[model samples]
Structure formats: structure tokens, C-alpha cells
Target: MTLAIETFHYRLAHPGYCAIPGAHPGQMVGSGQLFKRHESLLASPDPRRLDLRASLLDPFNHYRVKVFQQHSKIDVLVIADLSASMSIPGGATKLQIAADFLLSCAQSAFESGDNFGFIGCGHGIEKKWLFPKGLRMGRVQELARDLSRVRSGQGGNGLFQVEPYLPLRRSLVFLLSDFHFDLNRLSRLAGLFGRHAVVPLVLWDPAEYADLPEWGIVKFQDSENRRTRTLLMRPGLKRKIIEAYEQRRDRLRHGLRSKGAEPVFIEGRYEASALTNYFLQRVV
Candidate 1:
């Protein structure tokens, strides 16, 4: 069955630094509709954009030409954490949400005339899940299918090795994960992606913390290490568990903000409109 992919809108926070022309505001001066400034013809050397009035008014009598800001394209990438913990199901599996999110990104990027890429990392960068920047919808769909099948029992240590695969030029990067690991690793990863605009998609499930029973015996397994433990769920324990999750949320928020990344927390299921709203508010 074909998955339904919802497309969302986004814009770069700053002018694109890339030279390849496409559809985002850029610092490059070229043949675009937005006029930047008038420059001497000797410098700009574009007779077609010559300003006769400005040339005539020049105190030094130098020919003038108009310079316009050009629109440039940027790479859009999704770097997802495929650790075992991401497979835990609540309303939907985290990996399923991730795949849907990836589809949205791919569709959106394609509509916006930008190249999109995917990188799914676990213990290390998985070659099967690495896709370089491209505009092929077929490849994107294939990658999404592959992502949905992943059930890694490894940690997200491979994130450290992703820098080499990323574009050298600044791009918009979506980092998707449950982030059950150490915050220090997040800080380090943020530093590694310092050149790019990083948006952290924090995936969580209600079953993981919010919807626990107040009186029952619950068995929990560590997704990464395959360790199992049984706990008697009582009112006090439930409160403590929820409080712990809350504390972790605070830390993740602060950590991401400190590293100049604004995180979007997704609980239960993924929605395309929520992300679209984030970009809208950010642009505003």
C-alpha cells in the first residue's frame, strides 16, 4: 500500500549561501527580481541592467548597473536516529512516524525545488540507509520503506561519523530521534552540525511515560541493551516516572537551545501541519 505523504512549507532563516540557483533568498547577486543596489558597470559588467539615470547623475561620470539578489538552492537533509528505542510503539511506532516525516520532507523539498537527502544512523552510519542529496522521488520512497523495516538494537553512536557525508555548504538539517541517550552526545552532535541550521525533532510516546498505570506490575525492556526489568507500578512510582520524563524534557529543551537548535517535540503521531506552523512562526 502507498503511504500518504503530507507536504509542508518551510523557509530558510537566512539567505542561502549556495551558488546553485533555485528558489530561496540568497546573498549572490545575479539576474533576479529583487534589486540590491546600483554598481559601476566596470565592476558588475552587465550592460543589460545599466541604469542611465544613475549613470548620468554619477559625480565621477561612471556608467552604473543594477545588481539584484539571486535565489539559490540548498540541500535539505534528514538525519534520523535508528536505535532500538525508536521502535517502541505508542499510538504509532517512532520509526513509522519518522518514515512519514521523511516522506513529508521529501515531498516538500521537491515542491520547493531543493535537493533532499536521508541518513539513518545507529551504532554507526548504515550504508543501506544513507542517501545523498538528490531529487529522485523513487529513491526517497525506497528509503522510506527501508526505514520502516529497520529494527536496530544499537545505540546512536554513528551520528558522530555523519559529518563527512554532509554537504560542505550550509543547509537545513532535520535531526529526528527519541534522544534517550546522554545530552552530552547531543551537544557534541550539535557542534558537529554547527555550520548547518539544525532542527531537532524529539520523538516520544505517551506509553513511554505519560500513560502508565498507577497500580500494576509492569515489565520493561531496555531497547538498546535488551535488558529486562519488572517493576510494581504504584501511585508514587508513577508520579516519579512522569516527573523524571518532565525533567528530561527540560534538559533536552535547554540543551538544544544552548546549542542554537530549536526542538519540536512530537508525541504519539506525526503531523505535517505542526511542522509547517513551526516554520511559519519562526519566519514571523
Candidate 2:
């Protein structure tokens, strides 16, 4: 099915370490607009960048060549939770939102001359949903379509196994999940992703907590373990439930911040502009 994808602008706060030439500021010297420093012609060996005035004024009479920081490409990977909980629908199904976000990432990465990849994790890293970093927009679109049709059934423990699949170099990783599982697991995952820049997109539905009726019998099910519980809802009980959700949000935010990751909580729907604003306000 066709999906409406919205692209967002992003930038690395620090110089990228990739050797491949692309669009972001990099640590390598190459053909770029950002002038780094001047080097001896023998070192840089690029006559086109030779500074005539610097060459003439050299006390040692050595030809000085201008060296500019080379622009580089970084792998942009989306590590999504494909657990049963993610199948819950709010304004949109969580998986559908994830698919849309993936499409946007692919489009944005391509526009920025970067590579895009995706990994969907459930009980383990789902091989059917894995893609290595590449610049092909067609592959991304195809993958997004496939993702939209996925039937989530398992838990998200596969996230622990994702380290091997990730790029050895630093990358920008977008972690999409409702985070219904234990926060301790998230903390561990945060440690595993320390080498990469991680952005946690906390997907939540209002119906799960906020939209509950204050006076009625409520039935809730454990998506991961397939357990169900029925509770008599009242003002006091509803308040407690809302407070619990609020506490979870606080813990999530604090935990992510302590690990140097900023979490973006999407209560009902996904917004590309919110993500763009996040990068603008926090990444720098």
C-alpha cells in the first residue's frame, strides 16, 4: 500500500569519521567547501588547491596547498520494535507509523547523500525485516511496504542481538518502539548503542491509558505474554492508571537523557516536523 511519508532535516553535531565522501562535515581532507587548514603541497599533493599568496610568502619557499574537511556519509538505521505491543492502533497502527518513519528516513538520507538501513526486532532480529545500509531508494520503499504488512507476534528481545548488524563506524540510529517492556531492558540497549547516536521515538496510544472511561469495567491484555486482566474502572483507579503512565514517561525520559539520548514521545501520531525540531533544538 502507498504511504504518505514526510522527510525531515538532520545533521551530525560533530564531524563524521567516515572515509567515504558525501555531504556532512567529515574528518578527512578532500574536495569540500569547508577550509580546514593549509598543508605543504608535498603532503596534500593537490595543485588545484595551492594558495599562491601563501606559497609566495613561505619562508622555506614550499608550495602550500589548501586542505578542506571532506564531507562524508553516515549510515542511518531504523531499529524498530516489532513486538505484538507495537501492533496496537492509535491514530495509526504503531507498525504503520514505523513504516512511514522509515520511508521518511530513507528519503531524507538519500537527499543528504547518506545510506539508509532498517532492522525490525521481535523475539529475535527478524531476518525478513533486515536491510543493510544502502543508497537505493527503491529498496527502502519496498521494505517499508513489507513492514506495513507485518504481523507482530513476539517480544522485542531481539534488540540485544542488533549490535552485530550495525555499522562499526558511528551512525545515526532511530529507535522506534512503544516501550511497553521493562525500562531495564532499554537501559541495557542504551549501553549497547553507545557508539552510535540514538534517537528514541516513544510511540504511545491515547486509548491505552489517556482515553479510558472513568467509570466502567476495563479489560487489558499483555501483548507480549498473551495474558489478560479485567479491572473495574473508577475515578480513583483511573487516576492511578494515568499516574502510572506518567511515571513511566518520566522514567523513560530520565533514563534516555542519562545515556545521552533524547527521547521523543509521540502520544498518538507521528510528525516529521517534531523530529526536525528535535534535531534543531537538541542535536546541536
Best model per lDDT: 1
* Model 2 agreement with the true structure over 1-284: per-residue lDDT tens digits: 23666889998887889899988899998989999999999998989998999999999999999999899988889999898989865566788888888888888888888988888888887668788676378887878777777775787888777888888888899989888887887666755458889888998888888899989988898887778999999999888889999999999898888888889998776778998999999773
Candidate 1 structure quality by residue, lDDT tens digits, 1-284: 13678888988878998888988999999979999999999999989999999999999999999999999988999999888899875677888889889889999999888989988888898777788687488887877877777765777788777888998888899999999988877756755557888888999999988899999999999887788999999999999999999999999999888877789999977889999999988841
Q: How many clashes in candidate 2?
A: 0
Candidate 2, residue 193: Cα displacement in angstroms equals 2.8
Measured with C-alpha atoms, the lDDT of residue 89 in candidate 2 is 56
How far out, in Å, is residue 34 in model 1? 2.0
Give Cα distance to truth, residue 183, candidate 2, Å.
1.2
Residue 132 CA displacement from its true place in model 2, Å: 2.3
